[model samples]
Target: MKNTLPVTRYYGSKRKIINQIWEFIESENLEFDSTLDIFGGTGTFSYKAKIEGKEAHYSDIFKFNTLIGKALIQNNTHKITDAELNFVLTKDDNFNYKFFIKEIFSDIYYLEHENELIDIMVQNINRLKNYYSKYIAYYALFQTCLIKRPFNTFHRKNLNLRTNDVERQFGNKVTWEKSIEDLFRKFCIEANSYIFNNNRKNTATKSSALSCTKTADLIYIDPPYVSEKGSHVDYHSRYHFLEALVNYETFKDYVNFEKLNHEVKLGKTLEFESKTSISNDISSLIQKYNNKIIVFSYRNKGIPSIKELKNIFIENNMCCRICLIKTHSYALNKSNKALGEYLFIAKPKK
Candidate 1:
């Protein structure tokens, strides 16, 4: 199958293992009329499900990711038209655009000129008439921001890494120096290529995994990874700029002024990111979706051990199986030994 899904540089994305996941689903006969991707990061899994002719539902707490889901998964017929793209590229003189990114984000993430361009492009995107068109534009903008940043993350204020004349062993200075207008147009074309109709009504929601009231025949869970050493992968901190971009109306309130990078002080906490609470969180999810087949993706080095997770499945009266995939070293900690990617498949006892 052609991997037509838009590529995302999101950490812990399942893009590489999606084919293996499909193999597991087929081998286990876990085919379903409908499927839900709870953590829907990058919406790759949901997009894969849609490609397979299933009713796909995607949910994420982050507005940026949910917008990706809306653009690629939920939105079937709507696409960015040539005229719409032309409009997004054009600046309107009538409407006064907000300079929030330019004013507050100076010297933090992008060059001064790049920041100004983002401010202008986002304002143009807001003027789009169709909701899907807006999402498509946002999707492009988000990808463009990520591509220009070092490590493709906003974990630190490292604009100097891109601009400084220091000898750099790493980093793509050329891509970073590329004009935001050009990058935006490039990503818009990439995003436009992924939009299509699967004939079923797929939906995307912005909500926590446990809060989603929707049920499906299959539930795919790929929660945030917390290391056994107590380190947590906080998506909010890594992609706060994207969050700020989408929530520009209230961005200032969420930003942690005390921090150099201005990472968002998130209002809500994810239990899955806390080692003490992760086991319970996984158990709750299993119990809540007990009627549906559960497919979970985890790393060998994650906080909750494989044995504990399997016991949780058994305790929930479900038959469990595991598949191990040897993968490259994690991007965040390349020095660490390579880890196995584990996929836990569970189904109610017959």
Candidate 2:
């Protein structure tokens, strides 16, 4: 009934190439009430699967990504809109128009500088009914703002805005007013898919792929393939701001980060085990679901080495097969390359 939603950019967002990743499922004669997304890095796989007709059951260890799953997959709603953004921008227009520039700062940082705008937003939206769209829009803007922040990449919490004159000259960047964009338009069109919001059964608490073990249909696995460069790609920090988006309610009591946090790091926490370990477990699970075909799309970094995977899945039983290939991205970052991402099509070896 609605367009598909992209998985929010949780750290490990395979969003870079999930389109290529999902063609395997699309070609198959999938039969099942639900699709499971384990290691729900960005929930991209889950969202796509859900949009296509299968009941999507997604999970992630990150408190942030799971909320993304809910926002994008489970409860599709426009948290913002064109009209509301126009209004917010218009109201702030009288100001020097230099205040809304996109500079990086903490939740408290915005409260300190843009307190007036934030206050007005709360007041106006509170007065309106069915303001969910506007509320979401506010978040979308807020989330967008995080990216332009200096410390946003590693998400370590640092005051990275430029100096006074520098900020004065560019303060407008950090304080840019909320505006409607293409995704916002899509948000309007796609928000209709969520007909319900029951966080209990339909949702998976961990990776959606692993938690969804009950079904007897095609099971797809796209575990985190540790990149080929032998280095880890901490997806968590890459999209750390997602935590704020989902838990904005908790941020209402926002405090300043000028003194609290000011440095970001690549040593972010890992939410789950390595891909090989996970695939080993997934391989076993596929054996149990003998009646259904098991499909997997693994890249060089997220899951198994092709040789390791071939040994595991082939020995287990998948007889009939369809293969799709990926050559990796043009990105110089091995983390960006996606070699070996293919759908391992098979019915259990028995």
lDDT of 1 by residue, 225-292 (tens): 88887456588788888988888778878777788987776534765777789889989999999878
**Runs off by more than 4 Å, candidate 2:** 1-22, 76-152, 155-216, 244-271, 275-291, 301-303, 319-322, 330-340
What lDDT score goes with residue 76 in model 1?
Answer: 89
Candidate 2 residue-wise lDDT, 1-350, digit = tens: 54444423233346667666566556765556676666665566776666666677776655555555565656543454456654543354343432211233434234344534444443443334554554444344444444334433434443435323353433345333333333333444444344333232355344334344445355656555465456564554445444433333443233223534322222234323454355567566566555566666655544556666677766666665647565554222445543554667767555
Which window of ten consecutive residues has the lowest lDDT sum in model 2?
97-106
Cα RMSD for candidates in order: 1.6, 7.7
Give the runs in model 1 whose Cα sits over 4 Å from its true position. 266-268, 329-335
- Best candidate (score: TM-score): 1
Which candidate number would show the highest lDDT if scored against the true structure? Answer: 1
**Candidate 2's error at 75, in angstroms?**
3.2
